[model samples]
Every structure is written in structure tokens, then in C-alpha cells.
Target: MNINKYTKTDLYKIANNLLWTWDFEVRELFKKIDSEKWETTVNNPIKLLDEIDETEVVKLFNDNDFLSLFEKVNHKLDDYLKNKSWYAKNLNTEKDLKIAYFSAEFGLTECIRIYSGGLGVLSGDHLKSASDLGLPLVGVGLLYSNGYFQQKLDKDGWQNEFYIIEDFNKLPIELQLDENKKPIIVKIKIADEIISIQVWKLIIGRIELYLLDTDIKPNSKKNREITETLYGGDIETRI
Candidate 1:
């Protein structure tokens, strides 16, 4: 099993594939449908009365828009595959052992909102790469009620903050559900004290991530609300 960081060549190849002149061919039906939708957005903001007829829909193909959308989708798929491979390489050894991967980062591949920097992206890569390789690794992470804040500093040392919100349920992830189909909760010893934790499950495309929280009913308000802020807080806290 090969395991290492993605090299410059890998990066360049990805870029080249993205920039290639040849695009995925769009089916006539899809082209027609997409064109009609584009026309509706460009011309009719209110979508009054189905302005474009079926016949007109067929003629509405905007080649550039179609190509752009196709490329973006392909890029996303490519990224997922690459990340899946990384995960497979790192943790797929014990086939029969039920394994769960806990990480706080889990970048855009899991949720667009958790991107604090390269760390989340790296964690996402691990999850994706593991999934792609069919590694028996299940991902566990945190979903923010509020997205991570990335601080950017200017030359004058002024800090600028930006937020990325995460919708975990939308991301590809699975959960150990109770009989009611809700995420299963667990009890742990934190600081020599018993604490209960509730988990939230998310689906990140084809990836699976579970988020941990201590805000469940059984826990007291003194339990610190745990969620992804800079992305690694969960793993760090748990460890």
C-alpha cells in the first residue's frame, strides 16, 4: 500500500485535467433541459408560466455553460477518488475489524463549512481516499452549528475573518442509529467525570462523517458545546 502526501506532479496533473480542451459530451436530453433552465434564469426571473416550450428547450443549449458545469462535476469526482485512495492506504489493514475514524478536520469533501485551512482538506482526503479504496474506515467528525472562521492578516496586521457554514446531513456520512433511527449516543470519562455525548451524522457526497456533541438532554449545561470551529477541535478535545 502506497502512502504519502500528494506531490507536485499530482497537483499539476489535476490542473491539466481540469484545463483540458476536451469536455465530457452532454446528452441531447440533458443539453435541452439545461439550456431551457438557463434561459429561464437569464430571461424569466419569476419563472412565469413556463415561458420556454418543450421544442424551445431542445434549442436552448448553451455549450459553454454545459461544459463549465460538466467540468466542475468531474473535478469534484476526481477529488473524491483521490481522497478515497488516501484513506484506503492509511487504515485498511484489518478487514474484519470494525473500525471508526475520528477526525475534526474533514474538509469540503464532507462539508464546505469546515474548511479552516489545509488540515480539513487533508482529513477529507483521508476519508475520500479510504472510501475509494474500499477501506473499512468509517469517518467521525464534528459539524458546526456555525462554520469555521478563517482569519486572514493584511500586511499591516489587520485581521479579516470569513465563515464557511456546514450542512452535515447533506454530506456523505453514516451513523450508528438507535431503534428510532437516530444517532446513537455514548458515555465517556472526561476529566475523571462521566459525560454523555450525542452524535450527529452527515453525508459528504459519497463520504460519511459523524459529528459529536455534548449538548444532548442527558448532559448538563456545564458540558462545553463541542463543534468544529477551526476543524481540529473535536479530535484535539477527544484526545
Candidate 2:
């Protein structure tokens, strides 16, 4: 990005903190910086920064109003990250105990539309709330290439379904990487065949949500389509 000039600044860190979902000030700063781009990019600060003009960003960095708000928001984020919650100091759950939450879908935001209906939205809210409460929670779900189908009415009032395949690389998602800096591959047996699943990580505040993708190269054609769409196919597919 040739942003080394501003990469060393704490402003970069603040802009990259997706945890701004939980903070109003930080979210406002990004929006204020460029409301038009913010809306176009689905409130994704990282993408907004990436696509925004570097000259404009440099001007914002030098602006006194932007600098003032940036400092305040940055401090707020630092405090939030360091603050030891009551759950941390008082709650005594088993040290090795970890909570695993599984859901058919999650509607975290419209930008990443891997959800359908209210159940998905509810599941996403649960994960967000759990993270806010500082619970040791993990979410498991399948990553659909074509999330939920978009519905449109035909001339005769029949519903037409269309799917929008999103480019995951451009999205804010991060592929779970191992010590060797390669994607962590997980293998499991399904029926009599061994299938490989690639894990993708999404950050929901302090919590980590892991999604399994069966569309990797190691899987068979049929197996690769397992994670193609949400609520797709017949009862066998559901099973």
C-alpha cells in the first residue's frame, strides 16, 4: 500500500481495530474521515483505508480536528483492551474449559452475508454479546461461497433466487494461519472418505469465530460443494 509513512502511527492500529464495533468513538472517527467511502465499503475501516487516497489520508493525519479525535479514540481502545473485567478477576470457571457454539448460520453484517433468516441474525448477536461479556466462547459454522440467495419477484409474482458470490480475499476475514505462516488445514473422515477443511477466522470483539470451508482443493467434487450455499439442497444435504 506504500503506506509506510503512516503505518508506524497509532492511527493505523485504531483504524484496523474491528473491535470498533463495540466502541462508538472509534467508529465515528472512521465515518467522519470519509462518510461516503465508509458507507460504500460497508463500514469496513481496513478496506476504506486501503482504497482511500493516500494524499487525503495524509491530510487527515495532519488535521488538528482529526488528530484530536484520533488520539481520544486510540486511548479508548487501549483502555478497553487492557481493562481487566469483573469476569476475569472474579469468575472462576475451569481453567481449561472453553465454550463452543455451533450454529447453522451467522448474520454478523451484510458485508459478509453467510446467513439466512432470523436464526442466523440471532446466532450472530449471541456471539457478539458473549464477546462483550468476556466469555471464553468459540463459534463453529460452515463458510458458504454463495451465502444466502437474494430474492426477487418475477412478472407473475413468483420469486426468483440469485446468489452473489463474494471475494473472501478482499473482505475483512483472515485465514487462520499456523506457525509456518501457512493456512491451517484440518482433516476429518466423512462416511468412508477423508475430507479436508480450511479454517477461516472472524474476530467478534475479543472472541474468535472459526468457520470451516470444505471447498478446498483436497476435497472431491461432491465434497467441495458441501459448503456452497446455506439452506441448500434436500434432506440428505441437510444431514
Candidate 3:
């Protein structure tokens, strides 16, 4: 975890924040720094920051225009997180009412490919629409390591499948951290045995999407593979 010395500020935080996923301007700022790598990594800011040359980041840090834009974007994010929206201000129902959305897969974006088909696409659209409407929605889903296989046409026009192994650390998602900045682990009972699930958070504009991953070291090998692929098991396993 040796970060470059030049990243002294909260540059990683601002870049990894899911706000940039929706804000094209802020996303473009990161892309401007490294366009080639940006496209290669599916516009992943965390990956961009990690892989970009140290000298390039240093130059951007010293650039007044980049700094100005960075500060403004950070300020706007602070406001967005702290302030209440129209939905909160004008709500007439119970204040404690909350919506919990559950789906087998969610297609938030193609970059974070935890989706397989139309169901995930529809679920993603629902969350996006919910965010736009300022609804009190929380999404729950499993984090897949190798998301749905990417389809490609071979030279003979036959179908070829390519599965991508995603490095979660390089994505915009964040591990739910406790007061001491350690990952918060949640334990639950399934069947007759207990299992541990690590929670990862993805901020979808106004809403927060939480994905549970069973790929931690504490889990058994069988359990660790639960989140390995999308729709990749038998009927019982799928259930």
C-alpha cells in the first residue's frame, strides 16, 4: 500500500467518491490527467490515480487551474453530502420510513460489471431513477469478483466469453469502515452455520448502494466462492 509521496492531500478520496460517477465534469478532470489509462481502466479514478506516473500527478497538483477545479468539486461534494434535498424537506410520510431494494445483480455502470442481463439493467435504472427523485432507497446486492462474462465474436463469428477479474480496491466502491477506519464485518446465520460478509458501499448520487461480499479470508473456501461469478452455479447454489 505504498502510495506516491505526491498524493499528500485527499486526492484519492475525491477521486474514489461515487459522486464523480454521475458528475461528468469531475470525471472528465480525472480523465484529462490520463486519458489513455482512463479508457483502459473503464474510467476508474482510483486506478488512474494509482497507475498514473508520479511526475504527472505532481504536475497536476501544482497546476492552478486543476487545483481550482478540484477545490470547487470537493466543496460541492461536501455540500451535497451534508445538505438535505427536496425529498427530505417536503416529506409528509413517516421520517423513519426507508426503502430497501434487493436484487440478484445490479448494473450501476458497465465499468463495475456486477450484472448479467436485463434484470440487472432494470434494477440499475430503478436505482438511478430513485436517486434523481431523491428517494430514501438503499440497494443490497452481492459483489462479484468475475462479473458476467463479456461476449466477443471470434474470427469465425462464433461467440467467445471473457471473464474479467476485478480488483475492488481499484474501483470507486468503498469498504464500510468503522470509527477506527477498519473494515466493518457483519455476521449472519445461513441454514445452521454462521457466515461473515464484508460490506462495500457505492454512493449512487443521493442514494447509497451496499454490496455484500463473501470473498474475505475469514470465510470458508466454499463460502468465499459465493460471490465469485454471476449466475454461475446450480439451482440450489443460486437459491
Candidate 4:
């Protein structure tokens, strides 16, 4: 579909940012568009936008009530981004302090489920809390192509595991680019072989989270799959 025509809408703005994750009104706005799609996508606004029909899009655009709510939520997000927070007001120093937090997985939202358990949840919460607090913090984590496994049950009540490969293009993340407009890649030697890593950026409110990925053409098949799964494979994969 030609989504460019709708890019100027506030819906796209809200969908691209994780701020909608915490903003109830934004979530409600999305649900207002299509409740079934919202639930099926696990409250993912990006996917919802893609699935919504053009007729619905046109109808919503012409809707006065929808426009009013969109304006309200958009303004709120604007104010949040432009206004100074506690850290900015109280901490006045010549040099700005920045912190980098590293974790194996981050459970930011259900749609972007790279997290496996409590640790991922805690890490995700930390990033959200940091964003809310207006701290100059950056999160570092791995971008698993398949992320975690989805649970299923057989007719006999047996448990089954399935991995869903995520399309990063559909997700709320941007690839890091260099001055040449090429993807910014870093290389590091792991044992006898050198691994090339591509960087992806995930924005959380005012905070920035950088995710590392080994899934690229420069790397070998085995190395490319290094970031394919979360908490999967042997200890060698963990490294």
C-alpha cells in the first residue's frame, strides 16, 4: 500500500514512537481505529496502521471527534518532548552525564518481545523509568530476529514452541546510517573470526536504546544467526 499519503497524519507519528506504549489516550486512539486488529497485533500501532483499510483511513481522517482526540494526544506528546524534566531543572553542570545500560533482552512491549523472563521485564522497566525521569541514559541490547518463542498447546494438551521471525521494517525501529547513507556497521574479532555488527536504534520517549545485530551479509551463516534467537542454542551462541 502507498502509506506515504498517511505519513503526515498524527497516527504515524504516535505509532513510530514508543511513547504510545505508556500513553493510554494514544492506545485508546489506536483501539478506536480497530479494536480487533489492535488486540491481534498485541497493541502494536505500526502493524495496525498497515492492516487498516483505506476506507477506514479516509473515514477517520474526516472524523471531527477522531481529529480532536488526535490533536489532544499529539499536543501532549509535543509538550512532553519540548518541556524540561526534573533532571534538566535541578542538575545544572557544564558537562552532561550519560549512562549506558546493557542487557541480554528488553521487554519494552508485547509487540517487540525480545525478552524471555523477569530480567527482560526489569530491564525494560528500567528504560521506561529512565525516560520518565528524564535521565541521560542509553540502553544497549541484542536484536533477536526471532526473539522469544511463542507457546502453543496440542489437542492432547501438549506444549509446543514456535519462533516468529520479526520484520524489523514493520517494527518501530530505525537502522543506524552513516554520513554516506550506508548502514553503520562495526566489526570486532570473536575468536579466530571477525564478526560484523549492524546497529539499530529504538527510541523510548526521550531516551535512546541501541540494539546490536550480527545478522548481516558480511558475517558467516553461523555468525549471522548469532542474533537470530533469544536465550537459544549452546553456550557458544551466547558468546
Candidate 5:
């Protein structure tokens, strides 16, 4: 990724190919995702792109499944970064330094929810901006089965909240096993109830981020879905 000459399309294509490579792995990793998961999640890249663009990134997300996976729009930030020339200017910042940033939403692009909206996309852009400048920041967020909800305007221009659950175990987001072949699991206490958040680590270019999900067992029925609704609901989901 030569930042200097890379257009927005180039970056989008790079991301699209990375995802397509992962599509090959899902077939072998989780042998039996519900047929809907298989078709809806794993088998639909263009659909995901359109979904994100429609709901999050760009407002008009009228993209079709067969459309080019290239990001033809939004060179605004790129132009600014080039003008800043921060990547080349900040040599000292790249000297083995590290920074960690946490956020609830990450719409990486309209094409990828891993980064969601201004907050999330801004988070993603920050990550991108950092990378371009070779800055040391690790963006952190949950590897949600579905990261965020998308609200759309109807003909009436009112809003609707649409839930999109991702099959993280099968997509660009996945877990890495330790030498002992175990997926990392971390436990936390919320409102005096024991909640376990399974950690799924994802490699984002040069950065590494661990995502937490409470949608697994070993948790009480109450805790099993604690993370389902982000930023809302009581943490006292005790059984």
C-alpha cells in the first residue's frame, strides 16, 4: 500500500480481496453455519458493502451485489492527509511506539462494518490515518456477531433501526489460538453478575485488536447475551 499513489479505489480493492480470501476459510472453519448464515453472511460481500453504505457510510448506498468493490467516492480525507504529508513527516513517531484506542462502533467503511459511521468510521479513519503516518495506535472494539445497528430513512424520511448480526467467526474478523490451541476468553463483573466475554482477535493490517463477545455459554442465561445490545440495557442481567 503506497499511500502516496493509492486512490480510494485501490484501498477498497485491497480490502475486498482480503475479505474474499477469508471466504475460502469459513467453509472449513465452521462446517455448519446455518444455511442463512452461509448465504447471508459468508456468501454476500457485495451485499454487506451495500448494506453498510446504505445504512452507515454514504447515505445513498444504492449499490448492487455485482457492482465493483472499489470505493469510488470520498477522497476528501485523502487529499487532506496528502497535504499534511504526516506519514513522511513523522519519523520519530514510528520508532517502536504503541497507542491503544477503544470505541463501541467501527464502521471501517461502508463496505466493511469493522470500521460503522463518523465515530466508528472516524475511528477507522484514525486508524488509517495513523497507519499512513506510521503512528502507534491499536484501535479496539468488540468482534461483534453484529457490530452496530443501521437506521434508514423511509419515504416519510423517518428513521428505522435495522439490526445486522455478523458471523465474525467466518469473516474478516476471527480468533487466533494460542500455542495451547485455545481461543482467549476474558471474564468481567457487571453489576455484581459474572459475565464472560470471549475474545476474538483480529489483525488489521499492522495493528492487532481483540474483540469481546458475551454471546457464548458458561455464562448464565442472563449473561449469555449481555453484549447483544451495546451501550444500553442494564448490566444487571443476573439469572
Candidate 6:
């Protein structure tokens, strides 16, 4: 199916944003499209959209009940974004001020497993809170290709580790583009080598979270894996 046709619609806009992660009504609308696909995709709307065929998409958009709920959720998101909060009213003088939050991992949602434990959860919550309060805040973190490990037990009662590779295209993230439509790249020096990095942006309500990635072609394989695992590398890799 040609998913590009619906890219300009409100459904695509709502699905692309992380706001649906916290909103039950918005999630329900996605579930209404295909409940089995929704569950299989782990509540990831982007993946759900890709999996549905044209017939399913047509039936869904043509349903009156579905459209009603869709409009309600869309309006809720619009109002939430437009409404001012305490930060706006009290910190009007600090309009030029912006905060950058840095963390090794962020547990924004289950589908995006860039986080591992408690610290990551706390950092994710901080971003969400800041967004809700209308604070001019942005989050910075590394994009892990492996994103921690999935643990399983063997017959001998021992633990085993397996890493799952993430496809960024299926996730609700957008690659940062420059004015010329090229990817915006950042270069940093580590010892004698200069590592090239690309940025991915994830929307958290009104706030934006920028994730740094080093999996570009300009870097060596070793350097490309620098952002591979979350807290799974040696001291050298950690550095």
C-alpha cells in the first residue's frame, strides 16, 4: 500500500508524535484500525500504519465512529499544544532561555528501548514534566542500536543475553535535516580521530528530544558502534 497518500493527514501527524503514548483516546483510535496489528507492533502507530493494507485503511477512514474519535483526539492534541502553562505565565521574561538535559538513556516508551533502568526512567519523566509545564527544554541522549539486552534463562538455570537491532524507520522519530535537505551532522574529536554524528528528533508533546547517533558511513566500524549498547561496553567504549 502507498502510505505516502495519508502522510499529510491528521492521522499521520498524530501517529508520528509521542503524545499518543500517553493519551488513551489516541491509542484507542489506532487500535480501532487493527487491534491485532496494534498488539503485534507493541502499540507502535508507525509500524501499525505500515502493516495495514489499502483496503483496511480505506474502511477505517470511511467509518463515521472512527472519524469522530479521530477528530476528538486531534482537537485534544491541538488544544494541549496551544494552551499556556505556569512556565509561560511566570517566566515570560526568560523567553530566550532554554534548557538542555543530557542523559545516557531515556525510557520514553517501551517501543523505543533506548533506556535500561531507573535513571533512564527518571530522565524520561523529567522531559515529560518539562514539556507539560511549557518549559523551553530539550533532551539529549545517544541512540543505541542494540539498546540494552534481552535476558533469557537456559536449561542450566543460567542467564543469556541477546541484543535486538532497532530499525529507526519504524519508530516515531525524524532525522534532522539542514536547510539544503541534507542530514545535519555534528563532528566531535576523540583522541586523534574525529567522529561524525547524525541527529534524530523525537517529539514529546511541545518539547523536542534530540538523540545523537554515530552509525554513519564516515566513521570506522568500531566508532560506528560507539552508540550501540546502553551501559554494555568497556571503559574505552564508554569513554
Q: List the residue pairs that clash in candidate 4.
A: none
Which candidate, 2 or 5, has the higher TM-score? Answer: 2
- Indicate the residue-level lDDT of 219 in model 1: 65
lDDT of 4 by residue, 1-239 (tens): 22223333557788877888787897888898889989998888888888877778877767777767877888888888889877788774635688899999998999997899999999999988888888889999999999999999999999999999999988889999999999999999999999999999998888899999999987999999999999887899887
* True lDDT of residue 174, candidate 6: 95
Which of the two, 3 or 6, has more lDDT? 6
Question: In model 6, which regions exceed 4 Å deviation?
Answer: 1-8, 155-157
Q: Tens digits of per-residue lDDT for model 3 on 1-239?
A: 22323462467767755667667777877877778988987877777788867677778868777767777877777777677776777883777889999999998766888998899989988887777667888999999999889989999999999888998987878899999998889998878767798899988777889999988878888788788889876675577
Between candidates 1 and 2, name the one with more favorable lDDT.
2
What would the TM-score be for candidate 4 when compared with the true structure? 0.93
Clashing pairs in 5: 106-115, 106-116, 107-115, 107-116, 108-115, 145-166
TM-score of 5: 0.54
Candidate 5 per-residue lDDT over residues 70-96, each given as its tens digit: 222223223433454454465555567
Q: By the lDDT metric, which is better: model 2 or model 6?
A: 6
Off by over 4 Å in 3: 1-8, 177-183
Candidate 6 — number of clashing residue pairs? 0
Kindly give the number of clashing pairs for every candidate: 19, 0, 0, 0, 6, 0
Tens-place lDDT digits, model 6, residues 6-31: 32255778988788877789889899
| RMSD (Cα, Å) of model 6 | 3.1
Query: Which residue runs of candidate 5 sit more than 4 Å off their true CA positions?
Result: 1-96, 111-116, 150-160, 232-239
- Best-matching candidate per TM-score: 4
User: Which 10 residues in a row give candidate 4 its minimum summed lDDT?
Assistant: 1-10
10 residues in a row with least lDDT, candidate 1: 14-23
TM-scores, all models, native as reference: 0.49, 0.86, 0.84, 0.93, 0.54, 0.92
Q: All candidates: CA RMSD in angstroms?
A: 12.6, 3.3, 4.2, 3.1, 11.9, 3.1
Per residue, candidate 2 scores C-alpha lDDT tens digits across 64-129 of 787778778877777766777556767746777789999989888776778988999899889878
Q: Specify the poorest-scoring 10-residue window by lDDT in model 2.
A: 1-10
Better of 3 and 4 by lDDT: 4
lDDT of 1 by residue, 49-133 (tens): 1344544333332345534554454466566545645435676666687558876666642224655668777877776555556
